[model samples]
Target chain A: AQRVTQPEKLLSVFKGAPVELKCNYSYSGSPELFWYVQYSRQRLQLLLRHISRESIKGFTADLNKGETSFHLKKPFAQEEDSAMYYCALMHDYKLSFGAGTTVTVRA
Target chain B: GAGVSQSPSNKVTEKGKDVELRCDPISGHTALYWYRQSLGQGLEFLIYFQGNSAPDKSGLPSDRFSAERTGGSVSTLTIQRTQQEDSAVYLCASSYNTGQPQHFGDGTRLSIL
Candidate 1:
């Protein structure tokens, strides 16, 4: 069985402040992690993937095998960054997603 | 279409009625997936299709749920005898191939009364 846990349900950060969303997964096989973001009035879009190792919209997540964690982080948060963030683990050609964390950046 | 497209942006149906949701994946995309999004449940994988191979129906909750991709382009998800618990946003996504980043549709919001 594979499961993804996102500890935070809601996060509030001031503009220009750093933000981190915690995500932990339980999977026996090599995990493929992804961060998907849903902005207001928009469809869910790929934020970043662990395999790609590229940051999108200043957001980056690194997969930690030892800890079984893939936490998304941003150095400076912006109002546009406010959205629902989901951590997803792909295994067996299917995705298991964590209960999303809603981020609100206050100006 | 340039992106994944789902029909019937919103649907209101009574319990016990059957409903079918349609999805048109991006042209040339070979991989299609179906998911359910609800209040408590973030996203639940329903089924997946890759090329002509048999679909991975393991994620489907019950026999009442079924999906098929026609000619590797359009996909339809059918739910029979819907229940109140079936009310949720059904999402469709597609990728160039298996294990690739997927592009999502706007999702069809189903409300069972």
Candidate 2:
């Protein structure tokens, strides 16, 4: 069994400030981690994955196996970056998701 | 032909009625998935289809919930005797492989009154 936890339900930050969304997982095997984002009235899309190792739209995440953490980070937050973010773990045949965090960037 | 598409974008069904949600995955994709999103809840995995095989159905809440994927491209989820508690946004996703990044649809909002 695998589980994902995103402790904060809502996070608010000022525009141009740095932002980080915390995510932790519990898995024994080699697991795949991902960060998914959903904008207002839009479908959920893949923001970035740990395996990709690429900065997507200025956002990047590093997988920490020892701590079992995969936190999304952005150097400079923009007003348009405000949205719902979910962290997931692909375990076997199922993908378990975290409760999610609602990010609000105040301009 | 494009991204994953779900039919009946918004459905309002009465309690005790049956509802079916459809999903058309991207062309040539062999894997499909069904998920549910409720208020304040991120996304819950309901089922996954990998070339017509779903090894995980444990996420399904009850026997009233069922899903099937045929021809390895399209899928449908059926809920029998729907209850108000079942009202939520049903989402479908697909990928070329099990480990591939998934593409999602806008989802179908089901309201059981």
Candidate 3:
């Protein structure tokens, strides 16, 4: 079974501070990881994907095969970055999502 | 449509009633997924449909939950004899294929009283 674990339920950071949301996965085969963000009054949107290797809204996540981790990171937190972040693992055409981490960037 | 569309943005129903949620994927998307989001559970996958093939209903919590996709485009999720535990925001997403990034709909908020 493929599983995704997001250790933090809430991450609070001051503006301009670095932010990292930890995510770990357990899967026997190759894993496809994705980061989805949901802001207040908005629908969930794709923030980034491991396969794309592109950063969205200054957020980037690197998939580490050895450690089985795909942690999302941002150099500096902004008030606009405050939202719910979910890590998802895709395998066999199904996606298993983590419990999600709520990020609050204080100004 | 420009994006995945889900109907009945909000629904309130009494326990034991049946509810149906609808989803319309992107114009040419072949893969559609149904997920449930609750306060404590966050997001849970319910089912997946690829074209007109049989859906993957492994994530469904019980036999009361069922889904069907027709004409390889529109899908409907049916919940029979709803319970309070079933209250949650049901989300639908679509992707071009198996490995592509999915686009999400606004979600249907279902409340069971």
Writing each residue's lDDT as its tens digit, candidate 2 over B31-94 gives: 8889999976658989888884544677788999998887787899999999999999999999
Q: Show pairs that collide, candidate 1.
A: none
By lDDT rank, best first, the candidates go: 1, 3, 2
lDDT (Cα, tens digit) per residue for candidate 3, span B18-74: 999999999999999999999888788899998777888989999999998988989
When sorted by DockQ, best at the front, the candidate numbers are: 1, 3, 2
- The lowest-lDDT stretch of 10 consecutive residues in candidate 1 chain B is B38-47
Q: List the RMSD of every prediction in angstroms.
A: 0.8, 1.3, 1.1
Better of 1 and 3 by TM-score: 1
DockQ, candidate 2, vs. native dimer: 0.75
| Regions of model 1 farther than 4 Å from truth | none
Calculate DockQ per candidate and list them: 0.88, 0.75, 0.83
TM, every model: 0.98, 0.96, 0.96
lDDT of 2 at B111: 98
Estimate, for each residue in A1-107, the C-alpha lDDT of model 2 and write its tens digit.
68999999999999999999999999989979999999999999999988879999999999999999999999999999999999999887567899999999999
True contacts kept of each: 0.91, 0.84, 0.88
lDDT by residue (tens digit), candidate 1, B42-107? 799999999999999988888999999999999999999999999999999999999998889999
**1 against 2, candidate with superior TM-score:** 1
Candidate closest to the true structure, highest DockQ: 1
